[model samples]
Target chain A: MKKYTYTEKKDTRSGFGAGLHEAGKKNENVVALCADLVGSLKMEAFIKDFPERFTQVGIAEANMIGIAAGMTIGGKIPYTGTFANFSTGRVYDQIRQSVAYSNKNVKICASHAGLTLGEDGATHQILEDIGLMKMLPGMVVINPCDYNQTKAATIAIADYEGPVYLRFGRPTVPVFTDPDQKFEIGKAWMVNEGKDVTIIATGHLVWEAIEAGEQLAEMGIDAEIINIHTIKPLDEEAILKSVQKTGCVVTAEEHNKYGGLGESVARLLATTQPTPQEFVAVNDSFGESGTPNQLMEKYGLTDKDIVKAVQRVLERK
Target chain B: MKHTTEELEEIASQIRRDIVRMVHGCQSGHPGGSLGCADFFTALYFEVMHHSTDFTMDGKGEDLFFLSNGHISPVWYSTLARAGYFEASELATFRKLDSRLQGHPTTHEHLPGVRIASGSLGQGMSVAIGAALAKKLNNDKAIVFSLHGDGELQEGQNWEAAMFAPFNKVDNLICTVDFNGQQIDGPTEKVLSLDNLQAKFEAFGWHVIVSNGNSMEEIVKTLQYAVSLTGKGKPILNLMSTQMGYGVDFMMGSHKWHGVAPNDEQLKLALDQLKETLGDY
Candidate 1:
């Protein structure tokens, strides 16, 4: 297995803030809107630098979405920041009519996604956002893995035309991956290539998959790991190629098993080439208040969970 | 381009004819509010707004209009065609398959005049404010205008947008409500009373203007006055009052025709009531 290490740790939201600041500097037309929680979303730097272009929409997520859609009319790329729950389920109609159906160039940036939202519990933690956003026509759904990847995605989505839902998390995770990597919208990043088994992961689960890959290597089981950041436009070619080589797969994500990356991968395999697969995600149930680590462990989304899923899938194969 | 009050009235009569004809042609549409707001649409397109007949989605350097109450798309389609945004013959394809003229206003089919899709209520105010803010950002002197149904304010998103515009000081937006007091179910007052709308807007820090929407002269003058009130640090709201069905006498002031199409006899009677001054499509 390829050794991966990080010199530091950082929350993905800070990466989003850093990326937003950078995106604002690069494009004068890039504007940011927040429905309160500027601190939680880590958008203070962008707001401080580009005060004129920033709008503080004071807890009104629906209005924020509408305003962002409207801003796209006159050639402004508006990035709306809020919790993943508020960004999707709360203002779905607004996003549907004003942005997706209209095909507006608006980036719906959501932070604090999945179980990593921690003590805020199920109310703040949104596991079904990917499903909601992906169901919309012309909506680009992205869930970047770590700090560096999140920053790159934040800046990259600014240039991509049309509606995009960029999902990131609040928990501080290891800063793996290249700091200067070019973030592609629909391309999958091949983390480690092996032929024994395939491990597909997204968001916080990518790091866990890496850890699981290291463990699988020690047990004399070679695993191929792929980081699927873009959920909607799934990299079917990459998944099919890896799964054909491995003949078995383990899908991991910090989301519900029914609607997240696992289901997408399963559907792809079922349609193109049927492969034995195991899902390492929360079963169709809500999460409770706990530390990020505890929740991830209790809900079966840790590195150990991935290793177990990989073994289970290998048995099936 | 400018037109006299008489010319505007004549154009509005033609628009009313177009609205009834388009609804009758489709056999499915909202005609009551469309008929009610015909004069206001005519006034805005022909007299008040400084817009180009050659439309672009990014309406920079030109006054832009959004129909928030998109159920009344018949009026807007006629207004856009009359204003030369597209050919008048396209009006015949309203609500038909593969036509740009959708049941509600949409940019899905690349409609020339529409910048955003709006059929769901209470979303237009935020969109208008955002566009107005964009104009301010680009340093463009153009204004953004939008029309809404009075009953549509029942959605909570409207209040959110209402609070946001004033707080952000979005001064270049002029939004009008079709205060017809009628909706699909029944009268707004009986359904849900929007108590003292002027007071509500004033409290929200918007400059409120009340006008008779059915009269082209009053609507044009009121819109002009609303325009003059811009750039003074407050978003303007025009509460324009009108009957549900202003042109056809049988349908006037009733909510029954809100989303119903006129039959053959009813269409003839409506055409008889509204004079086709500029000729039908």
Candidate 2:
């Protein structure tokens, strides 16, 4: 397994904020709208830097989405910020009709995704956002792993035309990825190369996959880890090549196992190459009030969960 | 181009005829609101807005209009065609299979003069506010206009948008609500009462005006009066009163004709009432 190290731990939301601040300076057309969660979404820096370009939409997610879609008409690229639940499920019809179906160039930047939202509980923690967003036609769904990658993806999505959903978490995790990495939308990053088992992970689970690879290596088992960030328009070829070499794959994410990255992988494999796969995700259940680490451990979203999934998939193969 | 009320009235009568014909052609669509808003759509397209015949999604140099109550698409489609955005003959293809004229207005069909897709109600106001904000950003002096149904106001998003526009000083938009007391279910009053709508808008910090929507002269005057109130630190609202299915003798003063297409006998009677002043496509 490849060695990975980081000196700092930061929330992916902060990376999004940093990237948004940079994108504001980079492009004149980039504008932002936040629905009463500017501080929570870490949009303070961007709001401070470009006051004229930001709109504080006072707790109306649907209205924020509609306004963002409309701003695209006169050539303004609008990014709406809110919690994952409010951003996706609450204003789905608005995003669908105005942004996705209308093909508006709007960026829906969501923070506090998955169980990582912690103590606020199930209402705030949204696990079905990836499925909700990816189902929309012509929508680009991205869930970057670390702080640096989240920031890079935030900056990159600005140049991309059409609707995009950028999901990030509130928990401060490992900042392992390069700070200067340029984000590629649909390309998967191969974290470590191995021959025995393949591990594909997204969002915060990506770090766990890397840790799992190291653990599996200690156990005399070689594991190949791939970070599949962009869930929709998934990097199928990268996954297939890695799985073809390893002969089996394990998919992990901080989402519902039924309709998330695992389901996508399962469909692709079923159609092209039916291979044995194990899923490490929340199995159709809601999260409760707990610390981010506690919730992750209880819900089977940690490094050990990924390691077990890899072991199981290898056995199946 | 400034058109006289007499000329606008002539066009409105033709547009009403077109609305009936288009709905009749598809045998499915919302016609009640369309018939009532014919005069307002005609006046806005021909007399009020500074628009281009060559339609662009980013209407930079011209006034932009959004049909928030998009069920009333027939009036908008006919108005756009008459204003030279497309051929009047294409209006016949409304709500047909593979036609640009959807049941509700949509930009998906690449329909000229449409910026956003809306059959779902209460979204247009926010969209209009965004465009108006963009115009301010670009330093373009052109205003934005949007039409809504009074029934659509029951949606909470409109209130959210209502609060946003005034707070942000979105003064470049003039929104009109077709206060035709009818919807899909029944009379709007019985379905859900929007009591003292003028007072509601006033409380929302909007400059409110009232006029008869079916009257060409009043629609022209009220729209001009509403425009005059713009750029003074508040968005303007016009409470346009009209009876659903106004032009048709049998369908007027009721909600039964809201979505149902007219039968052969009813179509003939409706056609007789609305004269073919402009040549029918």
Candidate 3:
């Protein structure tokens, strides 16, 4: 296993804010809209710098989506910021008709996704956003791992034409990836390569997978870890190649087991190569109010959970 | 480019003919709203708006129009064809397989005049306001116009957009509500009463204008006045009143024809009522 460590920790939303400001500077047409969570979404810098291009939609997520879709008509790349719950489930029809069905160039940037949203509980923590977003035609579903990847994704989606749902989290996590890495829309990042077992993860679970990989290495089990950021356009080639080499897989994500990265990987394997797989995610159950770490542990989405899933899958293999 | 009231009315008659013919050909469509808004569509496209026949998605230098009440697409398709956005012969393919003229307005098929897909109600106002904001950003003097059904305001998103435009000072948008008082189920009052619409809009900080939508002269005058009201620091809303079926005697003022196609005899009667001044497609 490759030794991975981060001396600093940062929330992914701040990265989104930094990336938005950078994207705005690079392209004059990039505009940001927020639904009354400017500070929570870490969009104050972009708003302060480009006051004229920013719109404060005042808690109206549906209107924000419609406005973003409309902004795309005149060549403006609008990024709408809100909680993951409000961004998808609350405004699915608006996104479907105005953005996806129309094929508009709008980036729906959602923060505070999944159990990581913490004390806000199930209402704010959206475990099914991945499924809601991926089901829409022409929608690119992206869940970046950490601060650096989130920033890169925020900037990268500005240039990609069409509708994109960029999902990130609120909790501060390890900043392990390269600060200057180029974010690809549909490409998977190979975190660590080993032939014994494959561990696929996304969003906050990527860091956990890395931790689990280190633990697995100490137990004399070589594991191949793959970071799948883009879930909709799943990097089938990368996944198939890694799974074929390992013959077993463990999928981890801070989402429901039914509709997150785990299901996507399982479906891919079942169709292409049929590999033994274990999911380290919340079962089909809503989360309760607790600290991020506590909720993650209680819901079976931690490094230990990934290690256990990997061990279980290895037994199956 | 200025058309006389008589000429606009003649063109509207032709549009009404096209609407009924297109609906009858498809055997499935909403003709009541289409027939009701024919004159308004004719007046706006032919006389009031400063637009180009060659359509582009980024309508930067030209006035943009979005049909929020997309169930009435037949009127818009005819208006677009008559305004030379596309060939008039394409109207025959309305609602047919692989045709750009979908059941509702959509940009999915690369339709020349459509910039956004809209069949879901209460979404057009936000889109119009956003487009108007974009015009302000680009420093374009062009205005954005949108039309909505009266019953469509039942969706909560409309109020969200309605509250947004005024507070944000989106002054370059001119939205009109087809105040026909009729919907698919029944009259709007029975379905859901939009109590005191003028007061509602006025309270929302919009310059409200009321006009008879079926009359070409009134629609033209109202639109011109609405255009003059732009850039004055308020979004304008026009409540244009029209009968559900304006021309055909049997269907006039009734909601039964809202989404029903006319049969052979009914089509002949509708054609007899509407004069084909510019000739049928």
Candidate 4:
């Protein structure tokens, strides 16, 4: 197993904020809209630097989507930020007709996604966002692993035209990826290599997979780690290559197992190679008012869970 | 500026003829609301709105319009074709395969004169408010226009947008409600009473205006007056009163025709009452 040294820890939302400011400097047509979550989504930097370009849309998420879509009509690229819950489920129709079907070049930046949005409970923690977003046609879905990668993905999506859903988390996690690494939309990153098992993960679970890889090394179980940042356009080549070597898979994510990263990988493997797989994900249930760490443990989404899943998949193989 | 009653009536008849022909050729579309809003649609496209035939989605430096009640696409398609946004013959391909004219107004088809998709009511107002704010940001002295149905107000998102527009100083938007008092279910009053609509908009800090939507002269004057009230501190809301099924005697005063297409005999009767000013599709 390979070891990565990290000196800093940061939330992915801050990366989005940094990317948004960089986009503002790069393009004058880039505008932002926040639905009363400026401080929560870490969009204050963009607001402070480009107050004229940032719009405060109050608590109206539907109106924010429409406004973002409308802003694109005048050759402006509008990025809307809010909680993942309010961003997708609350305003699916607004995004469907106004942004998706209308072909508006709007970037929907969603923060505090999945069970990682702790303490706010089930109402705020949205585990079904990936399902809702992926079902929409012409929508690009990107979920970055760490702070540096999230910021890079945000800046990258701004330059890429069309509608995109950039999802990030609120908890501070290990920032292991190089700061200068170029973020690609559909390409996956290979963190480590081994020949026993392949561990594919996304979002906050990337770090967990790395930790699981370390534990597996101690038990003589050499696990390969793959970071699947883009959920929609799964890195099929990377996944299939790793599976060809390992012959088994373990998928992890801080989302529901029913319609999340795990299901996507399972579906791909079933069709392409038919490999045995285990999932480290939340069961079919909503979250509770606990801390993010506690929820991760309770919902079987911790490092130990990934390690166990890797072991279980090896047994199946 | 005042419009003569004879001239206003002539435009109404021509618009009605277009509506009947467009809906009949499509064979599947909502004709009742199109006939109901014929007079108002004619007034805006022909007499009131200062838009050019060379259309673009980014409606900069000109008044913009969005159709919230996009189910009544027959009227909008006919009006857009007659106003020279597209070829008048395109109305024949409405709701058919490969036609730019979708069952609902969509920008995906690259339809001219449509800035956004709108079949899912209650979304156009928010889009209009956004465009209005963009106009203010660009320092362009142009008003944003939107038309929504009375029943579409039931979508809670409309109230969210209704509360947001005035609070955010989106005053360049002029929104008109087709208070035709009907939806697909039944009478709006019996289905869901939208009483005190004027008071509702007024309470939201809007400059509320009322007019008879069926009268082309009233619609033209009222829309002009509404446009004159732009760039103020508050958004403008017009509760234009109209009959659900107007122009056609059998379809009049009913909600049954809200989404139903007119029969061949009914189409003939409607065309007979409305003389064709421009060539029919």
TM-scores vs. true structure, each candidate: 0.99, 0.99, 0.99, 0.96
**Native contacts retained per candidate?**
0.82, 0.68, 0.81, 0.69
**For model 3, which pairs clash?**
none
What tens-digit string does per-residue lDDT give for candidate 1 at A138-163? 99999999999999999999889889
Candidate 2 residue lDDT tens string, B156-268: 99999999999899999999999989877988889999999999989989888988998888888888888888889999989999988988888887899889999778888
Between candidates 2 and 3, name the one with more favorable DockQ: 3
DockQ of each: 0.88, 0.82, 0.87, 0.71
lDDT of 3 at A133: 89
**Per-residue lDDT over B132-238 for candidate 4, one digit per residue giving the tens place of the 0 to 100 score:** 77777777887888999999999887898899888888888899999988888998889889999999999998999999999876888899899889878889998
User: By the DockQ metric, which is better: model 1 or model 2?
Assistant: 1
lDDT of 4 at B212: 93
Q: TM-score of chain B only, all predictions?
A: 0.98, 0.98, 0.98, 0.96
Candidate 3 lDDT tens digits, B1-281: 49888998899899989999999999999989998998899888889899998888999889999888889999999999998999999999999999999999999998899999999888998999889889899999999999999999998999999999988889999999999999888998998999899999999988899889988878888999999999999999999999988888898999999999999999999899888898899
For each candidate, what is the lDDT?
A: 0.92, 0.92, 0.93, 0.88
Instruction: Residues A132-229, candidate 3: write the lDDT tens digits.
Output: 98989999999999999999999999889999999999999999999999999999999999999999999999999999999999999999999999
Candidate 4 lDDT at B260 equals 73
Output the worst ten-in-a-row residue range by lDDT, candidate 3 chain B: B1-10
